[model samples]
Target: MPEQFIAEESRSIGHAGRRELIAWAFYDFANSGYTTVVQTTLFNTYFVGVVAGGVGGVSPGLATLLWSLSVGFANFVVMFSAPVIGAIADIKACKKRFLLWSSIGCIVSTALLAQVGPGDYKLGMVLVTVSVIMFAYGENLIAAFLPELVPEEQMGRLSGYGWGLGYVGGLLTLLLCLGYLHWAMQQGMGEAEAVPVTLLITAVTFALTAAPTFIWLRERARPLPEVSGERILAASFGRLRHTFREARRFRDLIRFLMTLAVYQSGVSTVIVLAAVYAQQVMGFDTQSLIVLIMVINVTAAVGALICGHLQDRIGSVPTLAITLAIWIAALLAAYFAEERSQMWIVGNMIGIAMGASQAVGRALVSKFSPAERAGEFLGLWGLVNRLSVIVGPLSYGLINYWSGGNHRLSLLSTLAFFALGLLLLSKVDEARGRAAANNFLACGDS
Candidate 1:
C-alpha cells in the first residue's frame, strides 16, 4: 500500500514536470516561425530579388552584398550588447522582463515588414537588422532560464527537447508559408504581395505561441542589491573581466568554449552555404532544395531527441564529441558527392549532427555555469557564437575566391575548424568544470 502511494506521487510529479517543459519548449516553437519564414527562406530572397532589384536600382550582386552587410551589422550590435544586458538582468533578477521586451520588439519589427514593398530596400534592411538584434537578445534571455528550470542532469534532455520542438515549429511554419504562397499565386498575387503577407503571419505566430512561456515560466533567481547606474556599468565590466582573469581556475570550461568556437565556425559556414552547394554542385532545383531542407528539419529534431537522452546516459561532452565526429564525416561526404541522391544522404547526416551538437553544447555550458551567473555566461556563449558567424563564412568565401569558385575545396576547408575543435574538446573535463563553477560560487558567497 505504501509502495503504491509512492508510485502515484512520483507519477503526479512527473506529469507536472512535463507540463512545465512543454510551456518552456513552446517559446522555441513561437520564435521559429520568424527564423524560418522571415530570416531563412522567403524574406531575404524577396528583399534581394524584388525590393533591391526592382525598386532600389541595385544589381543582384550588389544587393546580396548589402544584405550581407546588414546582417553582419546586426550581429555586431548583438555581440557587444548581449553580455552587458545579461549581466544587468542577472543583477536585477529581471530576465523574464527583458525577454518579454525583446520578444515584443522582434514581433513588432517582423509584423511591420508587411509594410515593405518594391523599392523599400532601405526600410527592409532596417527592419531586418532591428528584428534580428531583438531576436538575439530574446535567445540569450530564454537560455538564461534553462538552469533555473531543470537540474544539471536533466539539462541536456530538456535542451534537446526545446531544440527538437523548435525544428518542428520551423517545419510547420515553412509549410504554412508554402501553402500561403501557393494560394496567393492561384489568386494572382505576385511575389512582393505574397511575401509581405507571410511576414505578417510569421509575426502573429511568434507572438501567440510565445505567450505560454511568459505565463508559465517563473524567475527563480534572486536580485542583487540595487546599484547606481555607474556602479552597474562598473560591476558588469568588472565581473566580465574577472571571468576572463579566472579562466585558469575554470580551465576545462574555457577549453570547452574555445573548442565550441572552432567547431561552431564550421557549423555556421555549412548552414550558410548548404543551399548554394546543393543548387550549384548537385543541380537541385528550388522545389527540391526546399524539400531537402524540410527533410533535414525532421532529421534534426530526431537527432536532438536521441542525443539529449544519450547525454544523460553517458555525458554531455561525450555526446558532443560524437556529434562532431559525425559532422566531419558528413562534411567529407558532402564534399565528394557527385550525384543528387548521394547529397540527400549527406544532408540528413548534417541534420543529425547539427541538432545534436547544438543541443549538447547549450546543455554543457549550463552544467558548467553557476546558477547565479547563468545569464552572464550564456551571454558569453552568445558572443562566441556570433563571432563564429564572421569567421566561418569569411574563411569559406576566401577559400572559394582563391580557388576560383572551386566549392568542393571550399567545403573541405571547413574540416580544419572541426578537427581543431575536436582536439581541444578532448582536453575538457566536464566534472572538473562544474566543480570549478561551484567552487567559485561558494567562495563568492563566503
Candidate 2:
C-alpha cells in the first residue's frame, strides 16, 4: 500500500516481476500478525497464563496440554479438508478467491478472540481453532502460487522472499502491539484490558496490510474445462483418488513429503510452544517475550534470504538437510538452557533453522508440483504438514502432562523428529523430483 513497502521487494532478488512478487509477499506480511501475535507470542501466553491460569484448579501443565490440543484439533480438521478444497480451487481456478476468504475468516475469528478473558479458556480455544484452520488453508492456497510465479530453480528464492518479508511484517506488527501494551500498562491497565486492544490492532493491521495482495496478486490459473457440468465436490474427490493411484509417477515428491512430515513436526512444535517455553521456563514477561521474538524475526529473515540463495546453487535437499541439523542443535541448547542469555541464543538458532527449513521445504515441494496440479499437490503438502502439526504439538503436550509438567523432557523429545527428518531427507532425489514434475507438465496424466 505504501511506496516504502513496494521498494522493499525491488532489490531484484527473486526472479519474478517485482510488483506481483511484492504483492504476493504482502500477503505473508498480512497474515504474519495472526501467527506471530495470536499463536506464537501473546494469546498463547494469555491462554496459558491469563486465560487458563489457575482457574477452576486447572494445573499449569494441563493448561499447556490444552493449548496444544487446541492447535492439534485445528490441524486435524485441516488435514482432511485441505486437499479437497484445494482440488476444488484448482478445478475452479480460484486459488486467490480461496485465499481471500480464508484470510477474512481468520481476521474475523481473531477479532472475536477479544471476547475471551480470564477463565474463558473454552471460548478462547474454540475461536483460536477457527482462526488457525482458516490460517492453514490460506497458507496452503498462497503457497500453491509459488510454481506459477517462478521456475523451479527460482522457487527457493521466491519462497524465501515471502518468508523474509513476512518476518519483517510480523516484527512490525508485534512492535505496534507492544507499544500499545506498554502505553496501556503505564495508564494503569493490565493484560486483561490491554490484550484485547492488541487483538484489535492485529485484526486491523491484517486487513489494511492485506489489501495490496488482493489488489495486485493475479490468479494465473485457468479453470479446467473437462470438469464442466460435473459436481466439483465429487470431481475434487475423484481427482484426489486419481492422484493417489498415480503416486508412483511422483515417487520423488512422495519421498520428500514423507521427509517433510517428520521434520516439520519439530518446526510445528517450536512455533506453537516457543512463547510458552520462554515464559514458563525462561521467565520472560510480556515485554521481554515480545523483544525476544522480535530479535528472532530478524535472524529468521536473514536465514531465509541466505538459504534461499544456497538452495538454488547447491540444491534443496542438501540445504534443507543442513537446516534440520541446525534444528537439532537448537533443540539441544533449548533443552539445557538455564540462563536467559542461553535461551536468547537458542531462540536465534531456532529462528535461523525455521526460516531456512520452511522456505526450502516449500520451494522443494513446488519444484515437484506441476502448474496444472499445483493446488492439488500443494494441498497434499498442506495435508502432510497439518497432520505433522497434530502429531508434534499433541505428543509434546502429552509428554508434558504425563511427565508432571516436565517441559524439558517434552522439548528434548522433539530432537528425535529433526534427526529422523534429516535421515529421511537423504532419501529425497531433488533432480528426479523436478524432472518428474516437468514430465507431468508436458505429458498430462489426465
Local distance difference test, each candidate: 0.80, 0.89
Question: Compared with the true structure, what per-residue lDDT tens digits does model 2 show for residues 1-446?
Answer: 33543354344334446678888888888899889999899988888888887653578889999999999999999999999999999999999999999999999999999999889999999999999999999999999988787767667887888888888889999999999999999999988889988888999999999998899888888998878655888999999999999899999999999999999998999888889888888899999999999998899988998898899999998899889989999999898888999988998998899989988999999999988889999999999999989999888899989998888889876889999999988888999889999999789675
TM-score of each: 0.89, 0.96
Q: How many clashes (backbone atoms < 3 Å, residues ≥3 apart in a chain or on different chains) does model 2 have? A: 0
Model 1 earns a TM-score of 0.89
- Choose the strongest candidate by TM-score: 2
RMSD of each: 3.9, 2.8
Q: Clashes in each model (backbone N, CA, C under 3 Å)?
A: 0, 0
- The runs of at least 3 residues in candidate 2 whose Cα sits more than 4 Å from the true structure, single-residue gaps closed, are 1-16, 228-230
Writing each residue's lDDT as its tens digit, candidate 1 over 1-446 gives 12442244236444325445677778888887787676556676677567886577976555555565666678788888888888888887889999999999999999999999989989988998899899989988888888877767777877888888988987887787778878898999887788899888888888888998988877877877766566877778777887788778878878888888899988877765676567656887545766787788889989998998899889988899999999999988888788899988998999999889988998988888888888898998887777675677566666665666567887876888898889899999998998888887888831
